[model samples]
Target: MLKLNKIFIFTGCLLVILSIELLLAQKQTKTYRNYHFVYDTADSVYVKKLAAKIKKQLHQIEFFFNYKPKSIITIIITRSDAEYTSYRGKIMPEWSQALALTREKIILLKIENADDIIRSPEILLHELVHIFFDDRITTHKIPVWLHEGIAQYLSGYELTVNDRIHLANALTSNNIISLTAMDSLFTFGQVKARLAYIEALTAIQFIVKNHGVAALQMLINN
Candidate 1:
């Protein structure tokens, strides 16, 4: 009986050790301020490179919104599109560089290589805005335009010449999308999605210009 009990104890300990090792291998974490990031060991260099930029952006965002995250935000950085899609559990649009699950306080980023990470520096900032807006604001009934607009605006996304040209073409062709229809813009193809983003940014600019920042802030506050 004593020998059998010793064997069971040894087996349990070995199983526990294996489980811990597996969990550790799957999730290596890096903490900066209120943001807690989980990524693979191989991507440590990439995460470190963006840490300073992310921290600075976070400060600016917090100051702009007058809000700090109440809890540590978990950001998961995936190594490939396949991994990202698996984590998201859906096929995202080509234009979707990153995503935020506001209620869950999670952000997912797909970084395939150094160039890919450097090419879209604003991607994480844009997602951060979504997390901040949803968490900081008290209302849940906000429009998609407002949500996306704020994210783009705060992320320093400006309508480029190409964007304006696209907008002009859209206007001339009578293909301009209405605010109501813009809610499903992400589901559209790449060209249409780009146009939708341009339109949204312009709408936000219009609101800020005509009503002043305070007025738009008041609207969002409620």
Candidate 2:
């Protein structure tokens, strides 16, 4: 009877240890000033580098906007596409690489490969810009085109050769979409969505060239 009791105690202790290890292995997090990076243990090196880049970007963004977020921003690095989709459930588009939940102050990134490591800085900065806009404009009155445009512009998004070809084709075909029509761009099909993004970026460039960055910032503030 005593031997059986000892066996039960040993099993219970083993389960407790396994539970603690499982919790420890689930996710790892590091805090850098206002940003908190959460990623898997396997991504420690990549995430460290990514976090440093993001911190620099955050400084630049804050300096440009002259605004800083009130709370610590949580950046979650998803291990797989499936993990990313799971966060947004059925509504998440398959083409989405990153998402900024501004209200929650959380950014979710789908980091699947070494190439993703190269692209991480740009994507992270893009989402951080979104968060900056959200923090400053709480009324949620900003138009979608302006929101995406400002984010893209400040994040240094450039028109690739393919993007230019797409835009040229769109213009020649008289299929150029107006900025207003892009309010629901994400819900559109992939081809249309890509064109809408290009249109938005061009519109922002025009605004900055003509009206100036101050004017654009004023528009955001007001």
Candidate 3:
């Protein structure tokens, strides 16, 4: 009888523990956040103004892709100088912030300010461009330039003054890179590190402006 009682106690304890584990698992699943998409209260007015501009810029790009105008976007807007410096790299405004993650999802950090030229609509569209062709970026043996360039082009952000200055220097000095070379140097500090960002943006601009958005979409579909 004592032995039987011990077995019952042990079984009860096991069941209780299992129940707790199940509850925790359910909570985690419920709380699994995807991306942070919200605006800063301080930048509300600026955000609205830029949003309109961005919408105008993206009109053509969206038409080309057949994307609904109301597509959802996820991004994190940073307000603090420390936050901006940390995320954007300890260098210059030419960077503003960076993009990290796969297509179908994107993480935009604080390099571009709410009051800056990034334009709200443009940022979202830029990230979508990354997501749109994310799969091709995976299989097409496409390089980083294609990834960044496409995003920059479709999004229609005029290069910031700082960015253009850097670009000018790089181009005049014959320091520009081709698609193949950009692939190798993208994540690495190939030629002044951030130079890859400019090259990618310029190249994408060239493709879309000359060949049309269909050329880019075909590459992704292929």
Q: Give the best candidate by TM-score.
A: 2
lDDT of 2 by residue, 61-172 (tens): 8888898777998888887887776664434356778887775677878888878878888888888898888778887588888888888888777888999999999999
What tens-digit string does per-residue lDDT give for candidate 3 at 1-222?
A: 979966765664455334333433322111112333444566566545545555555566556566542333445445555654433342233434445344224344453443544455666667756665653345565566776677777777677889888989878989776667765553455346567778777776777789977787786657
Measured on C-alpha atoms, candidate 3 has an lDDT of 0.56
Per-prediction TM-score: 0.81, 0.84, 0.58
lDDT of 1 by residue, 1-222 (tens): 979966765664455334333444577899987888888888787788778766666677788788998898778887788766655544346667776767667777888886768844578888889888888776467788787887887777778898999999999999998888877776798888888788888998998899877766787788
The weakest ten consecutive residues by lDDT in model 2 span 16-25
Query: What's the best-to-worst order under lDDT?
Result: 2, 1, 3
Model 1 pairs in collision: none
Model 3 segments beyond 4 Å from truth? 1-37, 68-72, 84-96, 103-106, 111-124, 135-141, 159-174, 184-186, 189-191, 208-210
Off by over 4 Å in 2: 1-25
Consecutive 10-residue window with the lowest summed lDDT within model 3 = 24-33
Clashing pairs in 3: 96-111, 97-111, 103-131, 104-131
Model 2's TM-score against the true structure: 0.84
